[model samples]
Target chain A: MSAEETVSQPNPIEQFELHRIFPLEINGIETSFTNASLFMLLAALGVVALMVLATSRQAIVPGRIQSLAEMLYEFVANMVRQTAGKEGMKFFPFVFSLFSFILIANLIGLVPYTYSVTSQIVVTFAFAALVLTLVVVYGVYRNGLGFLKLFVPHGVPLPVLVVLVPIEIISFLSRPISLSVRLFANILAGHITLAVFGGFVVLLLASNGWSFLAPVPLLAIVALYALELLVACLQAFVFSVLTCVYLNDAIHPGH
Target chain B: MKMTIISPAFAAESEQETHETVGATGGEAHHEGGFPPFQQENFAPQIVWLIGIFGILYLLMSRVALPRVGGILENRETKIASDLEASREMQAKAQAAARANEENIRLRREEAQAIGRDAQQKIANEAAAQRTRAETEAAEKIRAAEARISAAKTQALGNVEQIAIDAAASIIEKLSGAGVDKDRLVAEYRNVKSS
Candidate 1:
């Protein structure tokens, strides 16, 4: 057992490990530039290249790239309008950035040997925290303490209020946790599952009798990879949609 | 088979030590060996980059890209609306022209009917006047001819009687070698004719 442990271990989790590319110190914090930062930069560049570079022509009739860029803009714009109302359009930029960033990051991460930035809990949590912070700030600023009516139902008995208010507050407080973890966990789980299945294929190939059965896990990886691709885009959409919903709550808090 | 089954947890520890020692040399020297994601040393950099890059993206999107896209969409909408309006105006103009053309045709048709009726009335009046004139002229000619015939018949009758009387007188003279009185013979012939 001890001798076998020293040999090649099928370590799927090792894919997520970060190594510093450039050690960065800002004031005193260790803000070293790592693979995650690289992908994040790539994601931002991807957005700029698509949104800015693709639309330089500004044609009356859109070509393919312009059409694609316009479609994305309208899509997120409509989402914000529908979920958050016309007034919610104020937060359109923030929501659009979040959606595109997560979408690109998730998709790029699916490519082999690239880090999935969204898989990091801190990154996803930061977005969630930002969303929650904006909601509270905007909600209170716009509606004042009347925003607290979000927890207090309009037509409930006082007895029910005692139970319902706590539930509402708890659900409200858990928004960031759920929002962040949902994206992070989905991406993290999908990559880990793919890596594990990939490791199975490698291990099966190395074994003598089981070499022929390696195609099974390889097929499984293929299926899982497809699922992961769907998840990547879906989670991005879900995150933005949830953000819109929360912002809606902030805008009109009586409900 | 056993190696594959037992490796994830065991491999994580071994990977952790290597990463930690590497972390010690690197700036993140306070690293603990466990799950890579759960490790505290990696969080700050990812968060900083996320905030920094995300902020830049937000700025680019809000200031530049979105406005251009919105302008494109708005321009297309206005163009379509104006095109539709122009087409509608053209359609109205065509309809009015057709209405005027129909009105013109109707007026010409009524004028033609009125002119035809006037000609028919004029021809009827001329025909009636001609008929009256010709009839009056023929009647006058017949009356004159009748008057002349009557006069000629009367003269012939008178002459016939005188000739007869003379014939009688001549016969007597030739037979008896005597001259006869014309007035007496005429008177006698008249009395005989009367009787």
Candidate 2:
């Protein structure tokens, strides 16, 4: 038991561990650069390179890269058009960046030992907060206090509104939390599961005779990794879609 | 219970020994139960970099990537629409030209027909005038010939009358062997002529 206790653990959760790369301080602020920063920078750079290089030629006939870039452009463009009307296209840059950043971050995380920026709750919250902030600013600026009409459900009894109105407000207020948590949780869980299964392979291989059983977890890891990739892409899409839906409320407040 | 059954018995001890020796360097540092993300030390850097990277990304997306892409698409769309409009205009122009050509041909044909009819009418009038002139000449010639014939007949008839009188007188004189009375012969001739 003592010998067993001395043995080091497989530690799947440690993959999420943040490490300081360049310790930094600005005006008595602790702003040390870290692994999360590195991956985020990579993700952003990757996105920029893709967008810039893809559209550099601006060919009348699109190549693969240009097609991809244009596809992303139209995807968000259509989303905004559908959800928030043409007026909402003004916010397309922010929404597109949000989607691209999250997607790239998630995909980068799927690499063997990279940090997932979107997996960070604070990071996801930051995106969600920006979306909410834009919604509030646009809603109030455009509609004034009439923006409060979002909470009032139509075709319902006035008496029921007494009870239902608060619920509506609560749900409205919960948007950022739900949106942020959904993305964060998906990435967090997927990554953790992947790490654990990866750890399982290591554990099985380390033990005598248990090495034969390692292929099962390895296969599972392969499948889960595939699933994580899907989840990563889907989560990014969901985040952007939700952003559009929320912006829709800002644009047309009554409904 | 599962560990003891390994067939690679010789390698297991060496593996464990190395693992034990290097375990501190690789494993113990990461496995602490406290959540790695919530560690207060990591937040500030992540935020600062997040802001920096995300700002750059936003700039790239908004100012560079999006506008270029949008311009390309917009340019293509406008080009296509203008090309379509131009082609449509050209088709309409072609049709109009064809219609004008048809009209020109019809007008020319009608003018030609009118010219032909005018020429035919003018020829007919000239022919009628010519025919009338020819007929008048023929009629004048026939009148002159008829007058000449009537004169000739008058002269010849006078000569015949004189010859007849002379023959008759000579016959009477020769038969009777006397001179005939001129007044009596004239009176007989006049009676015969009158009869």
TM-score of chain B taken alone, every candidate:
0.58, 0.59
Q: Write the per-residue lDDT of candidate 1 for residues B109-170, one digit (tens) a residue.
A: 99999999999999999998899899889888888988898888888888877787678789
User: What level of docking quality does candidate 2 show?
Assistant: acceptable
Which candidate has the top score in DockQ?
1
Worst 10 residues of 1 chain B by lDDT: B21-30
Model 2 lDDT tens row, A125-213? 88889889989999999999989999997688999999999999999899999898888778876776665556667778889988999
Query: In terms of docking quality, how is candidate 1 classified?
Result: acceptable
Candidate 2 Cα lDDT to native: 0.80
How many clashes does each candidate structure show, in the order listed? Answer: 0, 0
Candidate 2: tens digits of C-alpha lDDT, residues B22-75: 111122122333345555566677777888889888998999999999999999
